[model samples]
Target: MQNLLSIVIIGIGATAVMDLWGALRKPLLGVPPPNYAMLGRWIAHMTHGQFCHKSIAASPSIAAEQIIGWVAHYLTGIAFAALLIGISGPAWIQNPTMGPAFAVGTGTIAAPFLLMQPGMGAGFAGSKMPNPNAARLQSLLTHMAFGLGLYLSGLAVSLIC
Candidate 1:
């Protein structure tokens, strides 16, 4: 039960930290925050067997897509946290380190790079974008921030739990 609580806290906290970076990136680097609505749209279409899209923004919107996207986004973060814990073991919860958290956080980019981006018609790692390198860099930096978030959240959990 305690481990579960710690996982929830770490996941939500780390995800929130990632979100904070997203919000700041627009002003700091001219990169707009990710559109979760589009993520939701993609997910909704998945229910009907639609996966690939030329442009997710061009796809028709669905009911409560914003809500769905937000929920899924956070849930994905939690799942990532579970992955980190599962790999690092309970000892990590008691003595959080940056290495494993960083590995898991940045490694998760595989989901977007290989699956999400390709499915959204951006090619691998947003290679189809007008500025693919920039897009890829942004993704890398964002995941790094998520890694930092995991470390920070783990520290808090360790101290409190």
Candidate 2:
């Protein structure tokens, strides 16, 4: 139960960090992030093997791809939190540094490379993008930001409560 809660917190925190980073970087660099909602949709489509294009970006899926993706997303976090709990035990669950946030953040590098980039038709981790190097960098940065967010948010929670 505690592990679940920690994972949820880490996931939310990481998402927030990614959002804030995009917002801050967008104005200065005129770079826009890929649509998060669209990303979510793409993830949802994972179970149905519909990872082609975003033709149905705005539509709903009967195959439960979207729901599955959302659930998987949260579950990933939970899994990370569980890892942290296992590694550090209960005492570190609320540590905020080496606990929930760290575990969640550390685990984020895989999604974009394996799932997200491929779904976006960019190949694994953006290898099929126009510029593979830039795409890979973007994926790394975003994932890193997410991980940092997880860590920071967990820290905040620990400090506050």
Candidate 3:
């Protein structure tokens, strides 16, 4: 139970860090923040057996999609935390380090590149976007920031637990 709690804390913290990066990036780099509503739309359609969309934007909007998307976002963060704990084991929770956390966090980008993006009709690695290269770079940078978040969060968790 303690370990689980610690993981949750770390995960939430890490995800929060990533979100902070997104929030700041818009003003600092002029990169618009990701509209998680699309995530909600994608998930909402999944309930009806619609996994892939030619363009998620064109897909019918679901009621309360924003809520669903935000929920999914946090859940995904927790899941990533679990993944980190599972890979590193309880010992890691006891004395969290930066390397493993960062690796796991950054590695999660594959989900977007291979699965989420393609399913949302953005093609592989956002290839269908107006500027695929820029999109890909942004994604990579965001994940790297997530990796840093994981490390920092792990440190915080270690201090508390």
Clashes of 2: 3
Task: Give each model a TM-score.
Answer: 0.97, 0.69, 0.97
lDDT of 2 by residue, 3-25 (tens): 56765775666666766777776
After superposing all C-alphas onto the true structure, candidate 1 shows an RMSD in angstroms of 0.8
Candidate 1, residues 1-161, lDDT tens digits: the string is 88888898899989999999999999998899998988898899999999999998888999999999999989998889999999999789999999999999999888889999999889999999999999999899888888888889999999987
Question: Of the candidates shown, which would achieve the greatest lDDT relative to the real structure?
Answer: 1
Q: Answer with 1 or 2, whichever has the higher lDDT.
A: 1
Comparison by TM-score, 2 against 3, better one: 3
lDDT of 2 at 90: 61
CA-only RMSD, every prediction:
0.8, 4.1, 0.8
Report the lDDT of model 1 for residue 153: 96
lDDT of 3 at 107: 96
